[model samples]
Target: MLTENESIIRFFKELGLEVTSIDLGIASEQERSSTIQISRDSYPGVEPHLVTIADIARWFPELTSSGDIRLKQPQPDVSNCESLDIYRQYWEQLLSVTDIIMGFLKEYRTRFSRGEYPTTSWAHYFMNWTHETWDSRRLEPAPIDSWICYVDPSIRPHIRELNEFGLITRESCSGHPDDHPAREPFWPYVMFEERAYPGISAHLFTLADMACWIPTYGRHGFDVSLEIPRDVELTRGNIESYWNQLISSTRQLMPLLEDYISTSGVDFYTNMSNPSLFRMPANFQCKDMSTTGDFSR
Candidate 1:
């Protein structure tokens, strides 16, 4: 089934209405899911699923007329409280830092290509850049527990929605480790490694991270990490080429997440213990968390 956004855009085009834009960025995936849930509660037995653009428009008339949908959430007042935005902030910060580091790597790569041995300053410079970036509050490695809290009960459904698209969680943390002492310790986030690249291989596009945190005393949000592998040659051209490939593979995450929020009716409650089969929607395979490896709490 086409996602809510895709359906809306297609429907509007069919109606001869030029859709300038669909505002999925401002509203979070969880908020859309909440809105759909509200509609389900209000009109019992209408349909268990909300998959088409008309489904959303029928429930939210404003979107039909204005091409914008905003669902009021029972959330405390906070600036940029949307989970997607929070996630975007974190992802973009890391991307920006990645760009900066990649710039240096490019220079190093160029020198290496010319058969010049890298000076110790290259390593020192990389460390310095990391320190400066963290000091600026622009980028930092998020704790996994905080991410688990922010996504549970709301945001994670969208993550699971990715399963339908051939992406599954390789490993995850429910964030409450102490609850099950006999089981593996609770982790803070989820990791999708080589499995993220279905047909593709090589370290360049094999890793992604999803995490969340409380940016303020009361406000909570999410962030993502994409690991771009440094080529053996360590050349800037190679780094950029690989980076582009990584982006192309994972760029759909935000948009698809927004669409899932708007229309998905799935709430996956799979038991991770069963590695051989997943409870996810059809066409998606069950995850194997055993090979996902240990993560920082």
Candidate 2:
């Protein structure tokens, strides 16, 4: 029986985002409604889209190791420049995930009456139901930790970017020989982490594996997941359907994204091959959608 405003407030509350104020300026006097605003502190910062390499090193100085070849300038003893291309990949992935979630919320609010929305609570939809869609294979939510965030091949370029900026990074093939490109796919990923010690590093460690932000994109559509009597099961169809929708949604939001980035002092780089792309401030890298391997540095 909660009002839509109340539901939104509750939803953000569970996620630990503080609500700063509710502006009623747009509401007619007789309507008695307002727009809710979240506190700016909830966002990481305007400086970098994600955490910076310098900050990561400062927080986790244990990145250097005894066996590491101490270079004159800052550099890791071993390097897999090829795998480093994925460093900034997470930014778009994160943003894409966020946009889709917002899209879900908007759809939910539009389709359901204030008090008759599905689900016991908004948090349930936000956390558990974001990824479930009909006519799609269920996507198992991956954990959002240093392994996925920093060490994953998708963000290797991001790590290398950090290293180029005087932040020391480490990489080990871990007995996987470098001569065989055929076995490269199965090689264990290098950990882009500080080696000062074992436990003191502030490596990337987001709980919920970013799953908390991904809503089920299955058959029910975004709004259906928010309503009562919703089906939680995955439907069989083109697994690419949800991803396609997400891509379409991202395309739709590009104008707003460009404006927001500009206002936030961020730069856009369409070419991942640009040598300076990573060194730039809060840069958004947009590679050709068809050519994923071209960005490998």
Candidate 3:
């Protein structure tokens, strides 16, 4: 039988993620462990949280592509009143989704793990009886180019799962240790694209629900955002604890997202009107989640 440490490394190897570091947190040595943690250089910089109006213009050029309106990235001394108005409209759409998600998380907790605990290898649970986490990790879907460059192994599958609900992820970080010489803002977070799909209400609510149901939430709940990218920040400070929650939570999220699609409807953006779909807001509109291809000129 491969040791838990090796199991983790093998898991990442298959996922094509470069493991920068791995520390099998043993419950005996650490207050609570047995949850293996690893850090890969999958994501290079701090995930962008509060991007400027100019950033939105670049991200969703389709919205700014009228012959009358053009956007340029703001230089240090530049000010943009035109883009500012458009930015407000974008933010309003994003905030509408955030509000819906917040309400859902605040109202429910029964389906989530009430407290953080040491769980066995996910590879063992999800895979055949052979290697524990190794097998389980193999079953996870491969990451697309954009996601592979940013989303860490633990969080990548969930990103893919989000797509099943008609959501698009913009950026993600599995998180670094507090003492890793970085600011806290470089937290464990998953940022979603503020797609114009029914205005992102479904995406926001799903992420908020992810925070509540993700294992080990009893102590370390996520900090969901109200601004652009509309992310949820994991509340753990230590790297090991952070990865544990991220990876372990994913095991449940996969099936849950499927069940959500099966019960509510696979076309997530189209199903916003389904009150059972995270009890979406009354005025929520379900629209196509695709952006018109990058509008050049």
lDDT of 2 at 89: 38
lDDT for each residue of candidate 1 in 1-297, tens digit (9 for 90 to 100): 897566655653442233444544345434332221112211111111111222222222111122122221222234544565653443343234323323322332344344443111111121122221121221222334445444444225434543434343344443333433577533233444222321111111112211111010001111222322222232435434443433443443333334433332222112222221112223332222223322211
Better of 2 and 3 by TM-score: 3
Residue 240, candidate 2: alpha-carbon lDDT: 26
Error of 2 at 166 (Å): 24
**lDDT (Cα) of model 3:** 0.32
Q: Which model scores highest in lDDT?
A: 3
Model 3 clash pairs? 123-132, 123-133, 124-132
Q: Which regions of candidate 1 fall more than 4 Å away from where they truly are?
A: 1-155, 176-185, 191-297
| CA lDDT scores, all candidates in order | 0.29, 0.27, 0.32
lDDT of 1 at 217: 9
- The lDDT ranking, best first, is 3, 1, 2
**Candidate 3 lDDT by residue in tens digits, 1-297:** 997556646654554333344433222422221111222122110011111111222221101111111112221122443444454454344334323333333322222233221121111111122222211211222345645645555555555665445445555565544433455545445554432132232224333333432211111122123111113344444444444443443443334334232343234333333222122234433221123211010
Better of 1 and 3 by lDDT: 3
